[model samples]
Target: MEIKLTDQLDQIYQDARTIRHHVFVEEQGIAETDEFDGTDSDAIHFVGYVNGEPVVTARTTVTKKGVHIQRVATEKAARHQAYAKQLLEYLLDQPMFEDAPMFYLGAQKTAIGFYQTLGFEKYGEPFEEVGIPHVNMRRTHSAADHHDR
Candidate 1:
């Protein structure tokens, strides 16, 4: 699989929306309004493709608090393939985020363990979002520690 990153709502981002539409909106029953959240225009999007078809998507927003990871989704048929993990690893390796002090996300209850394997730890109590349970997870970045992966 090849991972593509983009800051604009270009073709790569459009492909990401397709995957998100399937996994987040259609399958998970999340309202389209809540799923979009009007933030994609300002976020850095990442899309992973297999055989030229987009299968995984995630985005990041650089804020004063840290880098917020959002919109993580993988196509239903592509689950358990580690595409999300590889895409995130590629995202962190980019020069722009390599030294970021922190990274965080609101992980779906079922995906908490997956994020944990990527060095994120649960912080605040669990909460509900868009009718689904989620927990805030964070990972502090250390160049030395993460580089070993």
Candidate 2:
């Protein structure tokens, strides 16, 4: 698998769109308006490809405190194979996020356990976002943190 970073929409836009389409539009019935926020223009995106096929995609926006991970998704056929996990790992490894004090993501209720396995801890109470229950989660990084895994 190879992970690439690009700001040009042409680079990975379609792949990211496809993942979101599969997960939100086709699978969850979310309207297109809710999926494509204006944030993409400023956010950093990561695309993971397996054998030249785009299998996973994620985006992150850096703030003063940390990087916020969002829009993480993998093609249905790529589920259970750790493609999303690998994409996240690659995003966290980027130099821009290397020294971030913490990494945060708004995780879907059903997917909380997966992020927990990655060291993210749920914060406060769960709330609804776009009609889906979600909770804020964050992972603080320390020198001793085993991020390699």
Candidate 3:
């Protein structure tokens, strides 16, 4: 697996969008309008490829609170292969996030456990997002703490 990160809405970013489209729009029935969200132009994207085909994608936006993780998806056939996990672990160690206080995401109910294994903790009441049940989760960042994961 190869993971690429970019700020430009170039080919790598487009590949990320394709995976999101498949997972969120086609498979999950999310409205394209909601899934695209006008934020991609500004967010940093991560795309993971296997055998040269993009199969996993995620994007992050640095906000006042910290890094805001969003649009994480892996092609159905690629699920449970650790691509998303590895991409996120790579993302956290990037130079851009070195000074961030924490990382957070609105995790779908089904994925809460997956994020927990990455050191995230639930902190808010469950809520609906894009018509799916979700809960807010955050992981405090400590250079020493992250390495042990």
Candidate 4:
């Protein structure tokens, strides 16, 4: 698996869009207008490829509160390949976010277990986003704690 990160949408825009289209628009029935919120231009996008085929996509943006993770998806055919996990493992290796106290993501209810395996702790009551049940999850470990584990 290969994980690539870029701020330039032209780099992985098509692959990312394709996966998102399949996962969000087609499978989940989220409106394209709601799924594509026009923020890709400024976010740090990640695309995961398996044997040269892009199969997973995610993006992160820094906000005043914390780093917000969004649009994490793996192609339905590639779900068991762990491409999304690979993308996140790559994030851990980056030096920029080293001492952060927390990391946050709004996890789809069906994927809560998946994110928990990566150290995110689900909190609050379940809420709906994009017409799907979701809950906020926080990786409560300090950066050092996460890396050490």
Q: For each candidate, C-alpha RMSD in Å?
A: 1.6, 1.7, 1.5, 1.7
Clashes of each: 0, 0, 0, 0
Against the true structure, what is each candidate's TM-score?
0.94, 0.92, 0.95, 0.91
CA deviation > 4 Å runs, candidate 4:
141-148
Q: Regarding lDDT, does 1 or 4 come out ahead?
A: 1
The residue ranges of model 3 lying beyond 4 angstroms of the native Cα positions read 143-149
Q: Which ten residues in a row have the lowest lDDT in candidate 1?
A: 140-149
Residue pairs clashing in model 3 are none
Model 2 worst lDDT window (10 residues): 140-149
Per-residue lDDT of model 1, residues 1-149, tens digit only:
99988999899999999999999999999899998989899999999999999999999999887899999999999999999989988876678976678888999999999888888889989999888899999888773277466
**Best of the two (2, 4) by lDDT:** 2
Off by over 4 Å in 1: 143-149
Question: Each model's C-alpha lDDT?
Answer: 0.89, 0.84, 0.92, 0.82
User: Between the candidate structures 3 and 4, which one is better when assessed by TM-score?
Assistant: 3
Q: Model 4: which ten-residue window has the lowest total lDDT?
A: 140-149
- Where model 2 places Cα greater than 4 Å from the true spot, the runs are 143-149
TM-score ranking, high to low: 3, 1, 2, 4
Model 2: per-residue lDDT, tens digit, 78-101? 899999888887776677777889
The top-ranked prediction according to TM-score is 3
Give the deviation of candidate 3 from the true structure as CA RMSD: 1.5
Per-residue lDDT of model 4, residues 76-124, tens digit only: 9999877888897677546666555567899999899988778788888
